[model samples]
Target: MGENLSRRSFLKGAAAGTMSVAALGALAACSPSGAASEAAAPAAAAAGEGLAETGSYDVMSQMSLLNRNMTEGAVAAATPEEFIVQKGDGALQFAPGGDPLGITPADFMQNVPAWLGEAPEITDIAGTESCDILVIGAGNAGSVAALRAQEMGKSVILAESQTYDEYDEYACDMACYNSKIFLDKGTPEVDPIDVMNEYVRKALGHVNLQIVRDYAFRSGEMLDWMMADHIPAEYTEKYAKTSNYKGNENFSGQCAGQWSWPAMTQWRDEETNINMWPFVIRSLHTSLENLGGKVAWGYQALRLIQGDDGAVTGAIFQDIDGNYQQIDAKAVIVCAGGYGGNPDMRLDLSDSMRNLAWAYGADRTDPEMIGGMGRDGSGIRMIMWAGGTMEAGPRAGMSIGKNGAPGFAFGGAWPCFGPEGKRIYNESMYKFGSNGHLDLMPDDSLLVNVTDANWETYLSYQGYGHETMDRSSDYMVEEVRQNMADYQTGPDGFPVRSFARFGKEYSNVWAADTLEELADIVGYTGEAKENFLAEVAHYNELCEAGRDTDWGCDPQCLFPIKDAPFFASFGATGGQPSNGLVMLSGVNTDGQYRCTDGAKAAIPGLYAAGNTCGNRYGIQYGTPTAGNSCGFALTTGYCAAEAAVNDLA
Candidate 1:
């Protein structure tokens, strides 16, 4: 009856077309006879009676709008006790569901998701192979592990699900502080301690401090070593000498309250200006083959073969021809990337990201089209089935704001307004931090940014690692203009940018001579339009005053909207938000890269690196430098190989 009442209230709220805090509080009180339910009864009754009286109740709807609908104090005042889930760690507010989708954490951990059904019986093995170290997933980490292990004189087998051509392009940048290349170019030395400390703070102390410290100190040497024999020294030297952030007068290591140093080296080939990551990876594969290592292409790993002692001994694979093959190994390193392609895993783990996922139509299961391309959680699931543990709930992910457009880049301190036509966030926030706020907004809500003619000058104020405006202003503007000029007019006569890669079109960018016309194009109507103009006026006042009195945005980032040709950029306009390149969190692992148990004890014979390794990022993917994801992949993959080899010895 209690559950039925909850369902009835949910239906009522849905039918009423308003999921207000009061409605939500009523739904929460559906559970019977508890102090929490007792405390929530009045709010529930008022909301229920209001709905019953008018067939709709929305006076307190603004209370649920996490964007700019209500002040912080008002939100705090309206927050009900039932919404705050008290945990051992701390009080978690607005946790309508204690677990992801209301599924208990214990249930999530114990039951295998339907997508990852029971493992297939290994009754028929058409072929058999053996190796000292079997590396799964020929991505950034897997390839590195295979190469490092082969270089250590261990027989290695690197298996990949995709064809050689399919696994070509990858991370375009590499992070390595104090490398030989940086030293040679006379670049200022960055304190790795400061960087790691920032990482810990961003991750909320959920990261393995030892692993972070190791990466800070040894990653530079690993970078030097990885490229020593693979990429041409000339290309490395050229990019190291070049590639510094340009056009920013107030160039500093800080932007939007985030600390970011110019530590990542963009891997671009000097001859063709193409990404050098694939070239280096191809070179490594060639060298591995030359050194008697096997590269098994198109062989998808199905499951692990554990011995009586519960140690993973080998793995089962389904080849391209659908024939089952067995590869026995003393040790295995799972680096099949994270579970970004697995919607079930993402939905199960990322409680905080659910709204963001829904808002952007990004809750997808397609391996190629999903935010984390080609990551199907095969590696992580295999490890989990073999007794490995995942990092705690509220998993970290890389959400770098809107992608595939020439709008504001991630970490850009540009003024953005929410659906309510009110300013959203301290515009001077790192992309991830700002996107975290974006996640709190109602699903399908469009976040729009309005900027005037002097937008280029304001854009230069941003200095975060990912969107550091590395090129000249002329170059940046020219590139954007070229793309914008290519916009096609649909039947409705609205200009839309056609993203050929995804077969989708979006009319997110617009220009108008007046704020009113711009507001109409961006779908601001009635009260929203009035609020939009008022916000612009207030913002202009702040700009003229040379200070942001409201959100405390950096002075340089504040610009008046008086100039004509006002431009606007809208996110979630195409019904999908930007989910950066990949998800960052993964299986719980120790400093040695061995997958750990609940007690942090290493699970022998199994190792994880790259995105498959967890406890690297805290509850969110925050970084003091760009390319640390790829950097950690390279560093941990190499070191995991070293650890496996040494342990075997």
Candidate 2:
């Protein structure tokens, strides 16, 4: 067998799991629900009239769509599957062991070059501090490390760019099946071995099996500890039966394994119904403080300080007062989020998708920077300056929508009409696996979502863009909850329920009474426009036929554009798609969270956790699951702290 094929031998019995890039892209927007329709055609398709039928599906009832599409409809096939090129030869390389999928071990673990040419230099320091371990970014991953170090009685210091006292370090989503919640129930039916098996398959064997094993065995214990020691009891019950990926339960024999904090729940009023995450995080923060943990709220790690021999001793940090602070440490954990919020840094992953969720023109409902925090690119870049390699991933959890508040309704059947005026992907697969963003490239990303006026009026724009705003009187917020309730009530309910924030105020929406006019408004020109009209006509014919002969789209989403005043909405992607808006490319790490500086060696005393580190994904984001971003944060944070503590012991 080949070297890579040989490595798979050891992964056979391993039980491990964490993070799905796609799950993160869909869940990060603070919205929820999923569905895939495979049924009798909608009334509109059968009647050949726009007067009847609302095109959408019931996630609970129509699970076949989820099972069939989520499993089959990837951007490209894996293993022995034949490669079907989506674009020209210049399109993304989709070979099973290629850049957009998997790379050779040598290439993936290469050393970072000293000649990046643009990295900042570190020299003098205003003041120096020492610790047994120093951890950066007090978000999900960092918090775990700091607390775990305390458990081991190691002197630790944790730093954050934004002070939690002023701005909450929001963390709620946690996916692990080993906790008391699962173990206590005999028939919990979640197999860690099975989870790990699924995990490696999803990661395309590009991950370190050791890391998966470490997290797999420790997650339940860690979560149990958090529940018993850090968080209150009542909040634990609030966790719904969901996995990191929203629709994971639809998969056969896949236990409902995902959990969330209250505040992070979608469309709910943050002020009225408080999220338990803030409390859990704060409690951990307090535990760190009580253990005499040193936390620098406004201290930002600027560069990783390395010895001439390549041992990382510390980092150069920018203090709140604008002075440089030096941290002398035996070990360090970098946990700042990935470059999701940094548009410029995002070019590494998406040249066209340069903006993040909060960046102007991005069509997301949540106010977070692309992945989490601002896409500052600091943590990943700092390690790059120390010669750390980055994992090139096509999946950044970027499941974006054109209009209709893309976050809440990741499932509906709205046609994504490309420049060719053709259906680029199954509407459900828009963000699932279709790297349509890259294949479409410059102009194809500018595709539009054709919807009716009713979708825009009721389903879009649910609450304030920022969390600080009062949601008490926000009718949109209330309306969304009711809509969601109605949908969950079964056949008598609305076809869809959402808390989206799609409206004229978002600015990407356009309405035209005629298809020709609609095409003109969105910049469909020349043959593209001709293609657009032909597409609409052919699509109308298919609607009448009640089947998508061209793309296998669900009839539920096949409601014709025949309705006058038809609506189309666009966003910061300019209607383009992406692996995810978050800048997913970043520093490579061993499964142990040790930052690797090429094949020469893993830089000792230097580790990366959370989005700052890569390798949890081979190329695409977590496919079968979604919140791998957050899951990685928790898993690596706990594991990194354990490694550092063991060394000191």
Candidate 3:
């Protein structure tokens, strides 16, 4: 999913004298090709001429001349059009314009660099050590697990694929699109439970009930814990406000009805402990060391080691030096995130989910673009290999922009694209309709609509304290509205103002004059586009009259789409695709977090937490919710540690 930057970071720490170009050269020279001459002088001579370079090539040539000729003959038997473009920069440029035809020139060229038909083997393990409890992944869950276990007086080792400093900032200051009410001004009151429930119902069809309940019930407490630990409480408040309240008069009902309950709005404030995701990891890591718990950064867990009885006994990992080592543990907690980082695992999860991998491209660059490491689904796969059942497809704890548009920024009230982009949807509409729409539509389907009036209304509304909408709110609104209106009217209207911004692309905005045309331009067609436009037209008519019969869209709020040359752009449902944030299905465990296989479960030493355990909620995201993944990780890790200590006693 991402490149390993630990070595780079470590290399940065080396004294200037220790790290020389000579060292790099020496490493390169150690390669097989660099040492080829040592094997055989004749082979080295042949390699220089690109002839039968090695005995291996001679063997291949002798065995495959006839077969190669036959293959060539078969290929030549076809017309010139059948000839695949040979490998070269030129061939790649002209590689059969669209989608490629039967082994395209591009494919042929691509295959040239792929000398081996198989993937290269990975045989490196970074810094590894033993501990009584080993926590993999250093995100929200892993940090909590390590803290909880250490608090229980257990010797723990927390291993992260990346450094603690880098992991700490992963979420902090990394701009993302999140709908949460800011505590700055007139933010509406929202119930955490109702908001989350609606979120779950909308996102997952109320199928995974327990996960929703657990998250909702514990989220407030988690916020409190985070605040106490120095993360800003305003972050929670902001998230709740923009995401849950959506700025309606009956905010509580809107939240409760939606099954989302209030989480503290103060989470966004760095001063408040609510922004504790990063601070907590940093603090806990420091605190764990103070408590005599070991913390190893830049160590990647390669696999879980199990005894003959199949009980997890330890973990194998790679250190910064690329050395494999095994560490024994009384208990192993897999807190690595889901497959959002692993494209192949994502593809294998489900065809429907494959399209979702591109969703995060909006907020952050593609995983490939960022060279982000640590998304291999190794944690999920390791558990699966050990007979642990996976929940349904991955759930979203992140957001992606519409289509594959890049440079989409998160935050602010409503669906604000990066700086200077127009507001896409009425924030209230997100609270009222998105959950239901998400429930009914496919993952790739667009749920929100934007008309001239709605765009104007959104601009005006955001300034009225729609949570995260702040100082730049008016500017952002005006900029986006003008761009959209200009795109609708062309030169007949005023010249479109350009908002010079970094990483911003006009292509990010998909606009068309009509719903059908918009859909066609955006690659949605036929019944999908027709039905969507019909829905928009129907909604617009309702807005004109001020009543929505279908979804009870507020009449006072209805913005007409009657403006000539209507425009529609791709927008998200203000939520990431489901990416397994909380798993509702897993090994049945008691209140104590003990694993039970239903009939005399023998793995007494085994325990599960977070997404690894079974149902704790009925259905919902924050509605009537309890805890988040962090809370559960802490609680269960603590519970497991306590049980282990007592058993030993």
Question: Who wins the TM-score comparison?
Answer: 1
Ranking by lDDT: 1, 2, 3
lDDT of each: 0.68, 0.56, 0.44
By the lDDT metric, which is better: model 2 or model 3? 2
Candidate 2 per-residue lDDT, tens place, 1-649, comes to 2244222222231213333555345433432223332342222222223232343322223223443455455556453334544333323221111011122223333233222335677666899989999999888889888888877899899988886567564444455545665445432434667667666775668776776666556666676677688765555555322322111222232212212111112212233333346555767777888888888888988887778887888888888888899988899899887776654455434433433332435544323323322457788777877778777544354343222212223223366677566656555332233343434244224566675544433222211111011122244445543443333211121333222222212122355667787788777789888988898888879878978788776554456667665656432233433434344456777766788877837888888887776766554554233344555567778888988888667
Regions more than 4 Å wrong, model 1: 1-119, 182-186, 233-247, 267-276, 353-373, 400-406, 409-411, 433-436, 439-446, 472-533, 544-546, 562-565, 571-581
Alpha-carbon TM-score of each model against the true structure: 0.71, 0.57, 0.51
- The residue ranges of model 2 lying beyond 4 angstroms of the native Cα positions read 1-124, 170-172, 181-188, 212-218, 234-280, 342-344, 348-373, 392-424, 427-581
> Candidate 3 on 197-216: residue-level lDDT in tens?
55466555623344444444
- The TM-score between candidate 1 and the true structure equals 0.71
Residue-level lDDT of model 1, residues 123-156, one tens digit each, is 8899999999999988888888999999999999
Q: Which stretches of candidate 3 lie over 4 Å from their true place?
A: 1-130, 164-169, 172-210, 230-252, 255-280, 354-374, 392-541, 549-557, 561-603, 607-649
Better of 2 and 3 by TM-score: 2
lDDT of 3: 0.44
